[model samples]
Target: MQSKIEKHVMLTKKLALSAVIALSLSACGSGGSDDAPSAPRVQNITYEALPAMLTFNEGETVRLSLNTKGEGASGLKFNWTVKYLNQDVTFTGQGSDTISFKAPNVDMHSTMQVSVKLDEANSTKTFGFHDQHLSLSIKDLNPPTTPAHELGEEVSEIDTSVLTTGSTWTETHKQNSRIDQVDSSYNLVDSTLIRSFIVESADQNKQVVGTNYCGFPDLNSMELNASVLSIKCSSGTSSTQYFQKENSFSIVQKCDETIVGVSTFEKKSNEAIASFGSLNMQFKNFADLQTKEVCAVVATSKVTAHSADNQEVAKEEATAIRLVTQQEGNDFELHFAFNEAPNGFFVSLNSFFDENNKATIISGSYPELNASSQSGSLDLDAKNSISNMKGTFNFVLKNDAGLNEAVEGDFELVLE
Candidate 1:
């Protein structure tokens, strides 16, 4: 029985093997392929370098970047070194696709190098820096402007007011007064005295003669305009003459002649002047103000004795004059004094000098001024002198001042 079973098992195994062989033969016969097509494998690589080059100041921050391009990397790494004066600064990074770092403070211009690697890719970038300092400066690009008038010539007359509202006689003429006087006579004591009266308003014009020469720069090459101011006598002796000739008085910045520069007054008073003061001035240093040496001026109201109606008269009238050198701490200011007369004064600025030494005076219209108050401006150049002051002046009279009649105006003067 055992021999029969073994024979059966062997037959079964043989039958199975026969079936597998039959199947293989049938597939081959049908033209079916035994081998199958396979998909293609792909791989990529990328790399970028950091800071090709850079420049920055000592205190400024330097930015570094890693440039890269690739695909399928096992790992990425970064190694950087800042080399300066044979010294090295080394650092490392891991798994980082890109990185940035600031450069250290270097004494001089320098260059730093960086190296990066990823799988089979490697890159290098160089950063450059230059050290520099910061600094600023100002200067005058042009020469100073010369004075407008010839040397030894008289300066334009400036008008200024005295602050004497509540002061005494000594204080009124000394401290509160904006003007100082100096002359050979009267011990060079310049109280307020008006002279060389030339008043030009709307209808009439006149001129005053002066022989004194001041050493002002001959700047007769600039354009100029004329300006005028009228101040009435507000206080002091009332018998002031209108026009007096051959009268000389020095309008000084100092009460004593120790301080010398002056705008002297000669041939004082005029018939048309009714207790008023007029000043005629030419423009100088009008263009080159920045380069000119400017000074403050004080207008003195001088009372001069004159003849009226051919009578050897002893009368006093106010006139205006200025000093060559400016008074310390005082700019060009206008002051009008009147004894309770409304609109008793009229101050006008008619002209100024341009850059090219020419005359420009105000003529057509007179600027309105308040006779009640004594304050204004005198924009004039002290370095140059003015000689010719021609204008026509008119006045309105008040009843309390004794002479309440119409006063006509006329003026004239010559520069050095």
Candidate 2:
């Protein structure tokens, strides 16, 4: 019985083997099998750019990608690089399917480029490489732009409403002062001033100016504009005039020469006068900056305090100015002392001389100021950013109440 069962099983196996052999022979057909025929496919590789813009700006993040399409796209490899003026740019990501890089600065005369090499990284046979390259132009982002001037409903004036709401515009002027006992120096007191205005939806452009920037009351009586911000606000006896724009503001204070023991007045006369003042600051160093403006770094020392005649004691080292030199690609910040003096008065002048010598004046004392006998000049080399300031000043430190001690001296600033 066991032998009969084994014979039956053997017969079944033999039958199964014969069937497989017959099927294999039929598959061979008339054509001898050399290799399997490939399916119909397109040979070209397609890729899309993440950012379609051909012309770019500095600091813009750029990316390139090879999208899946056609035959063997998944097997494709990418070699990527960015260049500025032919120099390799810093980039990120594995150079396989996609890569990214930030646009670097391009000088006015330079060019930018992005290159990618597409090929099969892994293949048994040799294949030609497909190279993709892009040459583009990038705009420099560090350079200052000319702000747009909007016209008010009234023609011939800037639209003050266009001014950013709640934004306080600050103006700094550097010019010679007029007070004989206060701000005056042929060279030293040229660049030191502070002024400002706040933009409002409802008559925020109020003027604040006085004699020597003395004092003023608020009254929106003066006519001004949105494109050109000018406000007239007088507190009481003194009249105030303030003008503002997108980037700067000007405060014109009509000085009352009759007022004494107050801050210095503007242009006591047509002639220049001897003047001086002690330099005080709100900041301890470059790290400190409370107010939205810059104060000059004035030298004060009992040892170097010189006298301009007799009552005018601020001279030479007493009010010698220390300024930060201009640097490329960095905002030129002149170290200033924003101090609230004993008499609640502070004076500063500024002249920002760029290619056009765009200079203005700013004063922090007595709230407002007027044009001086000497209009100051500043040579600001502002190519990439606001640069250094070089000028002279004459100042005085008044302490008549016998409350606070007089601080006076020489100062020289060197920033590397």
Candidate 3:
């Protein structure tokens, strides 16, 4: 009996051990198959587009474009579509995996919603220009004769939102005259704009460099979008600029930190015009902004006014422009708009793309102004030597008419 019991116990132990081993094997196989890794699932898509606002002067044809990028954006086809003023507009072969858009001169969309779809993922953007009731009422201590001068208390209500707070900007002017370097910066505040800068650069004409700095909350404003930037510059000083179109945009220097002008659009086009109170910024030339960047420079020139009309006045004028940027690279192109100026006044710019892939602008002239009394012998010479080009510039304003005066300055070119 004892032997039989012992045999039964041994047989039971063996059966239990075998069952346990089988169950462990099955569990291991199940875990191995279930936990196998798989490819990542894409998420967090973002959308971007150009011409944040499209402006059409009633019956004017308009163009629109769309661009997008994000996770899960690769190796996928796209569908580009638009809804303009309740109308459906579509474009074929207009979408791509990375970058795509509808060509220029497409249908006009007074109000628009644009969409891009790619393999189970999609994004959309809204584009339109609304006629805003913008009013400017701030009385200028010294006003120019234009719609701007009529701007009274209405100026107070004007879209100050365009001028950002917590935004800062700096400017400088280097010249041969006593006012070698004129420097200043701005800080947007609740009541008035805050600013400060200095002046230097005498005798040593090595290379007069001036810089201007600006600080604003965001890139949204009539001044930044399509308005004139005015400043009061000291007599006999001028400036040129080198800018980071994508990272660093600059403004024309102010003489003694005093200058004012209404930002207006360029004539015929939606571009803005730049003017100054008792001053003029004459843009001589543009330093090739590093490739793939948009640069903004304010150039000012001064001329004596023989007539109060601001027209028919023979004055010595120097030019400068406030330079601004968005990004920098080789695959980038720049489109300019006039954010501020008077109606019918035109603003034009010049750029140079050299053999070494470096760009050098000879100069830009505002060919749309009403009169040219100071156009006698004032010319910017940028076609000289072109080797080992160290960043150096020379500005000359010849008031041979003795009718008015002029000023000039340049910038330090830094390539990153």
Candidate 4:
């Protein structure tokens, strides 16, 4: 009985193993097929056209054609539309891919947009439709006429003997020249003269002052006996300017064939020197020379002031001075350091002088010394007609603690 039972159990185990092998093969086959077909890919649409930008005149005819590029493109349906000034107009088959039409008349200028769309004949309303566009501008065909003479070629000449050297001339205008002083001596080699002028201009209704110097070159060869005189000037660079004078007054000044300024002047006086003055400087906080006379070099282009005792101050920093003079009443207010004054810790001063050689300091300040409260006064004694000057300055500076510190000194300057 034991052998029979054991044999029956072994047969049952063999049957179970056969069932497991069949189930394994079924799962492998149900997973996937290696040769299964893939989903269809989307089609790409492209085209080529001649004359990408089209321009036509009114009443003219134009022909435009498009050649499509894609798979199964020839089998696709085509729709052509033209839009102009918010209106859309549809065109029918001109053999499917070509358009030939006459441009409409336009009063001034007009633009037309032409487009073509391609799709399957039985396609449903959907996104991703393919289309191409072309822009056409139509206008009246009118060309500009040739000018009589090139601009700047039509200029006249004048006599130069009327302009006298060493004479001062004056003109009154809103933002032009007020006075011009010519040097007494002329540079014979280059036929030029040193000219200085005071100019005032309105910038946003605020007066702006500027001083200009130019080497006025002779243009006598160009001016024969005409009413207009033509003279040239150099800007100390690669620039050369031309000025035309009619009846002893400047009518036009040009550079690079462009007019820059126009003005008229009347002879003011024969006085050579416009105005002259001296400068004095001292520092209370720093130890150097207590006080010193300033040496000045004056020229048409610039005026430079420096300490006569170079050991006291460096040459570069001591020579930072610019002179500007304004004729107000009987006094010439000499503005020193104008826009070139050193900021933060440096002191700048301005003085005024009268015809009698009297001098006074109008303003003085040390920018960084006193941030809150600062007051100063200058006492000036004029030595001679601006050739020499002596002055003393007293300043009281108050810090945040309201503690007042006094700065006092004196100086002398002579023109060289």
Which residue runs of candidate 4 sit more than 4 Å off their true CA positions?
1-46, 49-52, 69-74, 88-95, 119-129, 143-416
Q: Tell me the alpha-carbon RMSD of every candidate.
A: 39.9, 29.9, 32.3, 30.5
**Residues 298-381, candidate 2, lDDT per residue (tens digit)?**
322111121232233333211223232222222222332311121112233222221111111133321122112112222211
What is the clash count for each candidate, in the order shown?
A: 93, 57, 109, 3
Per-residue accuracy of model 1 over 1-416 as CA lDDT, tens digit each? 12221221121111011111100000011223458443221224333333333444444444443433333223334444443222444333434544444455532222333433332322211111111111100111221221223122333422111111221110011111111112111111123222222322211122222111221223111111121112221121111111111223222222111121223333223332221223422222121111112111122322222121112223222223332212222222222222111121333322131111111121112112112111222223223122323333333322333422232323333321
Cα-based lDDT for every prediction: 0.25, 0.31, 0.25, 0.34
lDDT tens digits, residue span 1-416, model 3? 12222221221111011111100000011223556964343333333333223333323333433333445434234554554323444444555623222322311111234444433332212112111111111112231222322322222122322223332232232221111111111111111112211111111222222212221223222232222244323231222211222212333222222222332211111122111111113333422333212223332223222221112323232232222332222222111122111111232221121111111222222212111122112122343111101112222323244323222223221111
Question: Please, what is the TM-score per model?
Answer: 0.17, 0.25, 0.18, 0.25
In candidate 3, which residue ranges exceed 4 Å CA deviation? 1-144, 148-290, 305-314, 321-416
Give the C-alpha lDDT of model 4: 0.34
Runs in model 2 with CA error above 4 Å? Answer: 1-45, 48-53, 106-110, 120-130, 145-416
Model 4 over residues 1-416: C-alpha lDDT tens digits?
12222221221111011111100000001233558754322244344543434677767876776654555445445667775544554454643656767776643334566776654441342234435567676754542211223212222332233334444444311111111112111111101111233222212222122222211222212122221223332211112222334323333443223232333334344443443333333434532232121223221111121122111221111111223322122111122221111221323332232111111222223223422114554454534212244556555545576545455555454431
Q: Name the weakest run of 10 consecutive residues (lDDT summed) in model 1.
A: 19-28
